[model samples]
Target: MAAKPNTVNPAQKKKQRAFEGVCKSLIPFARAAAVIASVALLLFLTPFVGIYNKDIPGMEITVGGFSAALCALSGQFTNVGAAFGNMDIFNHFAPAHCKVLAACAAAAALCLLAALVLCVVLAIGKAPGLHSAAAVLQALAFAALIVSFAFALAMSGTRLLPEYCSGNPACSVRSLAILPALAACAGCAVNFAAALRYRKAKKNI
Candidate 1:
C-alpha cells in the first residue's frame, strides 16, 4: 500500500498569508506612531509638567506642584526643605497628603522613563521577545500613570491650603501636570497595539 501524499489546505493557507500581509504592512507604521507618542510623553514629563510655580509681589510663600526631588519654585527660597525621599517645599507647606501625591508622581516618572526606553528598543528591533517586552512595559507604565493621577486628584480635592490659595490666586496646581501622563498613556496604547499585531502575525506565519 502507498501512503497518502502530504497536502496543504488552500483556504487556510490563503487566510494565513492574508493575515501575514496585513501585519507586515501595518506593523511599521504602528511602531513609528508609538515612537512619536513615546517621545512626546517624555518631553511632556521632563521640562513641562514636573513643576509650575508663580511668584508675585508681597506673597511670602511660593505655591505649586510638589515633586519628589524639589519644589516647583525651589529657586525662590533659601531652604527648599529636604531633598528626594522627603517632602519638598510645597509638600512641607501644603497638606501632608501632598507627600503621597509627590511619591506617586515620582513613581510615574520612573515608569515613563522605562516605557520610553522599551519603546525605543521596540522601534529599533523586530525580535519577537522585544515586542512582548514592550507590551508589558507599556502596560506597567499605564498603570503607574493611573495611580499618579488618582493621587493628584486626591491632593487637589482636599485643597492645598485653602487660605494660601484664597489670598494668592497665582498659587495653584498647574494643569500641565496631567498632560504628560495622558500622553504617555496614549503612547502605551499604541505600542501595545503594535505588539499585539506583531505577535498575531508571527503566530499566523
Candidate 2:
C-alpha cells in the first residue's frame, strides 16, 4: 500500500497563522530595541566626570554614573570635603549641578532597562499590546540621557565644569576630552535617525 501524506489539522493551521502574525507585528519593536540598546550603552560610556585642573592632560577625576549618583544622593562625599554641585573657581560661583545630572543618568538607566525588557517580550513573546509602553519608555530614557549631556555642556565654559578647573591658563576644554564628546555626538545623531525611522514605520502599522 502507498503511504498517505501527513497533513496539518485546521486548528494547527490557525495557530501557526496567529503566531506568524504576532511575529510580524513585532518587527518594529525589535528594531527600536536594538537602537535603544546602542544609545543607552553609548551614553553610559561617558564618564560621571569632574576634575581639579583642565590644563594637565589625563588628570580629570572621573567616576562611574552609578557611583556618582549614589555618592551625591547619600551625601557621602560631602564629609570628604567634596561639596558636589557647589564650587567656586576663577572668581565665579559655578553651580555644576553634577549631583542632579548623576541622578538623571541613573534614572535613565532604569528606564532603558525596563524598555529593553518590554521590547524583548513584545518581540519574542505574544505581548504586542505592550509596544506603545515600551517605545515611550525608550523615548524617555533617550530624553533623560540627552538632558544629562546638555547639562554637562551648557554654560560650563567648557566640556565639563571649566570653572572648577584651575591651573596656569587652563583652557575651556582638553584635547583628550574632545574625543569622547565627539563620539557621543555621533552616537546621538545615530540615535536620532533611528528614532525618526521608527516613528515613520509606526505610522504604517
Candidate 3:
C-alpha cells in the first residue's frame, strides 16, 4: 500500500492569505496619517509671529502632536502640563494666552516626540515576528485629536488668538489670524476623515 499522501488545506491557506493582506494594508495608512500628522504638528513650531499667528496653526500642531504622542505611548495620555513652566519661550507672551499656549505647546511637544516613536514602531512592525497594536491605536489617537482640536478651536474663537491681545479686551482682534485658523480648519477635516476610516477598519477587524 502507498503511504498516505500529505494534504494541504485550501480554506486555511485562503484565510492566511487574507490575514496577510489585512496586516499589510493596516499600518501603511496609519503610518502615513501619523507622518502627516507629525509634520503638521511640528510645523506649528515655526516662529508664530507677525502675519502667521493664529490658534488654528497652533491647533494643528497641538492636534498632530497629540495623535503622535498617543502612538508613542502605546495609546496612553500622559500629563506633562507643568513642564511648560520650565520653558523660557512661554515667558514672551500675554500672561493669560501665554500660559494657555505654553501648556498647549508642552503637550504638543510630547505628542510629536511620541509620533517619532510611532514612526519607528511602524517601520519595524513589517518584519517577521513583530506584534504591534499601534496600527489600531493610530486611528483612535488621531480621532481624539480631531475632536479635541475642533473643541479647542471653537473655544478659542470666543477666547482669543494670542496675537489679538493687547493686555486688555479693548484691543482689536487681528484680521490676519483668521487665515491660519481657516487653514487649521482644513487640517481638522482631514484628521476627522482619517479617524473615521481608522475606526471603520478597526470595526471590520
Candidate 4:
C-alpha cells in the first residue's frame, strides 16, 4: 500500500499566514530603521560646529553666504544663531557679519537626515510618485553640496582674512568648511543609495 500524503492542516495554514503578515508589515519599517541608523552615524561623526568664524569676516565667506541665505529665508539671521531658521534674510550683511552660518549648517544636517528617512521609506514602499520625488530631491541636494564644496575651497584660498592665519596654529576657513562639506557628501551618498534601492525594488517587483 502507498503511504499517506502529507497535508497542511487548517491551524498550520493559519499560523503560516500570520507569520507572513508580520513579515510584510516589518519590511518597510526595517528599511526606515536602517536609514535612521545611517543618519545617526553621520551625526555622531560631525563635529560640534562653532560660529562660522569667531575671528574675522573676510575669511568666512562660506559662513557668510550661509548666513545670507538663512537671513533671506527666515528674515533675521543672528536671532537663530547655531540653530534652524534664525539667520537674517535680507543678505544685507555678508556671511561674515552674522552668526547665522552655523545655524544653517545645523539645519542642513537635520534636513538631510529627514530626506534620507523619507527616501528609504518611499523606496521600501515602492511608491512610484514618492520615489521620483526622492530622486529629484537627492539631485538637488547633490548640486547644493557640490556648490558648497566649491565655495569652501574658494574661501580657504582667499587672502582676504589675514587674522585667520595669524593664530598660533593658524587655522584656515577650510578647517570649518571641510566638516560641512563632508556632511553634505554623506547626505548625497545616502540619498543616492536610497534612489538606487527604490529602482532595484521596482525592477524586482
Candidate 5:
C-alpha cells in the first residue's frame, strides 16, 4: 500500500487567501477600536451623567460611575439641595434596588477592561480565539451601562449622557457624555467582523 498525498482544493485555497486578506486588513481597524475602547474606559470614570449649571459654564454637576451609583441609590438627581427631592416619589418605596446601579457600573467597567485587553492582543497578532469573546464582552459592557442608567431614570429620575433632559428650562445637557457608548460601538463592530472572518476561515479549513 502506498500513502495518498493530501492537498487543499483550489476553492479552499481561494477561501484561505480571502480570509487572510480580510484578517490582515482588519488589524488596523482592531487597533483603532482598541484605542476607542481605552477612551471609553477613561470617560467611563468621568461624570457622564449630570445636570448642567446654567449659571456657571463647566459648573455642570455630574457624577462619575460610582458617585452616580450612590446618587441614584440616595435618590438624588441634581447633586443640589432641592434636587434631593427630584426622584420620583414612588421610588421612595423601593429599597431593594439598593446597590444595583453601583454593581452594574462596576460590571460595565470590568467587562470593558477585559475586552480592551483582548482587543489589544488581537490588534497585535492573530487571535482568532479571542475575537468572539472580546466582542461579547464589549457588548455586555455597553448593555450593562444602559441597564444602570435605565434603572437610575426609572427608579431615581437621574438624568445624564444618553438621557435627554435638555428640554428642562433650568438645566443643561452633557451631550458629549455619549462618547463612551460611541467608543463601545466601534469596539463591538470591529470584533464582530473579526469573529465572523475567523468563523468562515475555520469552516473553509
Candidate 6:
C-alpha cells in the first residue's frame, strides 16, 4: 500500500508565515533604533552644558561643572580655562569628582556601543537568543545613562564650590548640559521598546 501524504494545516501555516514576516520587519527597525540611541548617548557625553560667565556671553566659565563628558580625565578643563580666562579657577578643585563622573559616562558609552553591536548582529542573524540578549544590553545601557545623569545633577547642586562664584557672580551652571542626556535617555527608551517588540514577535513564532 502507498504511504499517505503528509497534511498541512492552511490556517496554522498562514499564521506562522505572518509571524515570520513580522519578525523580519521588526529586526531592522530595532537595529536602527539601537544605533540612533547609541549616537545620542555619545553626543550626550560632550560638554554642551556647564557654568558660563555672565560678563562674557560666549565664554564658558568652569566648563563641565555638571557632567564628565568633556572635563573628566581628558584635561579638557585646561583648554576650557585657557579659552575663558577665569573658568579654570573653579573647575580645578573638582578634578577628582569629575574623574568619577567621567568613568560613569565612559561605562555608559561602552554599554551603549556593545548594545548597538549586538543589535546589528541580531538584525543579521535573527537568532532568538540574540533578541533577548540585545534587549538586556539596551536595558543595561539605559540604566547606566540614567545613573550618570543622576550623579551629574547631584554634583551640580552639591559639589559646585561657592568660592568659584564669590568674586564673579556671573558664573552659573547651564541647564542645557542635561538636555543631551535627556535626549539619550529618550533614544535608549525607544531602542529598548523596539527590542521588546522584536522579542515578542519572535516568541509568537
Highest lDDT against the true fold, candidate: 5
| TM-score, cand. 4 | 0.44
Q: What's the C-alpha lDDT at position 188 in model 2? A: 38
What are the per-residue Cα lDDT tens digits for candidate 1 across 1-205?
A: 9999989899789878887565555546446645654564554333211222366443233222233324322332224443332234345444444545555455555666566666555555544345555556555655655554555445444445364356455554433445555666676666667667766766775
Model 1 TM-score (2 dp):
0.59
Model 5 residue 131 distance off true place after TM-score fit, in angstroms: 1.3
> What would the TM-scores of all predictions be?
0.59, 0.56, 0.43, 0.44, 0.66, 0.66
Residue pairs clashing in model 2 are none
Error of 6 at 54 (Å): 2.2
lDDT of 1 at 129: 45
Better of 3 and 5 by TM-score: 5
Better of 3 and 5 by lDDT: 5
Clash pairs detected, candidate 6: 62-87
Candidate scoring better on TM-score of 2 and 4: 2
Which ranking of candidates, highest TM-score first? Answer: 6, 5, 1, 2, 4, 3
lDDT of 6 by residue, 25-47 (tens): 76666667566656655565345
> Candidate 5 — worst ten consecutive residues by lDDT sum?
85-94
**Candidate 4 residue spans exceeding 4 A from truth:** 1-72, 75-114, 123-129, 157-160, 163-169, 175-205
Report per-prediction Cα RMSD to one decimal.
Answer: 6.3, 8.2, 9.4, 9.4, 6.9, 4.9
Q: Can you write out model 3's per-residue Cα lDDT over 1-205, one digit (the tens) per residue?
A: 8998888788766766765565555455445545654665555433322212343442221223223233234322333443221122222322343334334434544444454465446444453112123333333334443443343334344434344353343332221222323333343344345445444544453
Q: Residue 30, candidate 1: how far off, in angstroms?
A: 6.4
For model 2, residues 1-205, the per-residue Cα lDDT tens digits are 9989998788777766765564565565465564655555455544544443545765345444545445546645443334332212211332355555556666666766676666566555545555556656656665665665565444355424433444335534211222323333443343344445445544444
Sort by lDDT, best first: 5, 6, 1, 2, 4, 3
Predicted structure 1: lDDT: 0.50
Give the per-residue lDDT of model 4 (tens digit) for 1-205.
9989998688767766664444344445435534643543354233222224555653333333344344446655446465332233212223552333344443454445555666566546444335444434444544444454344344434343444334424344342434444544554455455445545544433
Q: Can you give the lDDT of residue 29 in candidate 3?
A: 46
Please, what is the whole-model Cα lDDT of each candidate in the order they appear? 0.50, 0.50, 0.39, 0.44, 0.63, 0.55
> Which has the better TM-score: candidate 1, or candidate 6?
6
